[model samples]
Target: MNILFIEDDRMNRRVVRDMLDVAGATMTEAESAEEGLQLIDTQDFDMILVDLRMPGMDGITAIGHIRAREDEKAKLPIIVVTADAAVDLRDRCIEAGADDVIFKPVAMDALFDAMGRLLARDSDGMLY
Candidate 1:
C-alpha cells in the first residue's frame, strides 16, 4: 500500500520507513505539515500517518485542512502518531478527522494492526 508519513523527527521517520519497507509497503515521507499537505494535494495514498506535534501547522490543523477538501481524498484514512497520550489530545485528533491514534514509540505490530483494520474498513466501504 502507498502510505504518506508526515513527521518532523528524522529518526522517527527513518524507523517507520524501515518498518513499512520490511512490510512491503511503500512510504513517502514529509518533514513538516506544509509539505504533507502539498503532497496530499498532488499525490494519492492509501493511508496517511501524521505526527501530532511539529514546529508549525501541527497535525490537528493538518487534519482539519485535509477534511476540508471537497474531493474524495477528504475521506482518506488518517492515523495520528503522537508521543503525548493525553485524553484531550486524542479527542481533538478524532474531532479533527483522524481515523485512529497511535502512540510513540510505536510498536510495529500495533501499527500494522491499526493499518490493516482501517484499510479493511475502507475497502469494505465502512469508513467515511
Candidate 2:
C-alpha cells in the first residue's frame, strides 16, 4: 500500500516511517503540509496520514485542501495522526473530511487496525 505521511518532527517522522515500512506500506513522506500537498497533486496514495500540528498548514487544513480536489483524488481516505486525543479534536478532524483518525504517539496495533478498516471498506465498497 502507498502511504503519504506528513510530519515535521524528525524523530516522530522516523518512527512513524519505520512502523509503516514494517507494516508493508510504501511511504512518501513530507516535512510539512505544503510539501505533502504538492506530492498529493503529483502522485497517488492508498492512504494519507497527516499530523494535526505542523510548521505551515495544519493537518485539518491539509485534509480540506485534498478533499477540495477533483474526483477520486478528492475522495481519498485521509487519516489524521496526532497526539491530540481529545474527543473534540477528533470530531473536528472528521468534520474536516478525514475518513478516520489515529492518535500519536501512534500505537502500531491501533494504527494498523484503523488502516485495515479503511482499506477493507475501500475494497469492499462498504463502511468498515
Measured by TM-score, the strongest candidate is: 1
Give the top-scoring candidate (lDDT). Answer: 1
| Consecutive 10-residue window with the lowest summed lDDT within model 2 | 119-128
Candidate 2: residue 80 lDDT (0-100): 90
TM-score of each: 0.93, 0.92
> Which consecutive 10 residues in model 1 have the weakest lDDT in total?
119-128
lDDT for each residue of candidate 1 in 1-128, tens digit (9 for 90 to 100): 89999999999999999899989999999999999999999999989999989998999999999999999889889999999978698788888999999999988997998898797784555855
lDDT (Cα) of model 1: 0.92
Q: Give the Cα lDDT of each candidate.
A: 0.92, 0.87
Candidate 1 error regions (>4 Å) = 122-128
* Candidate 2 structure lDDT: 0.87
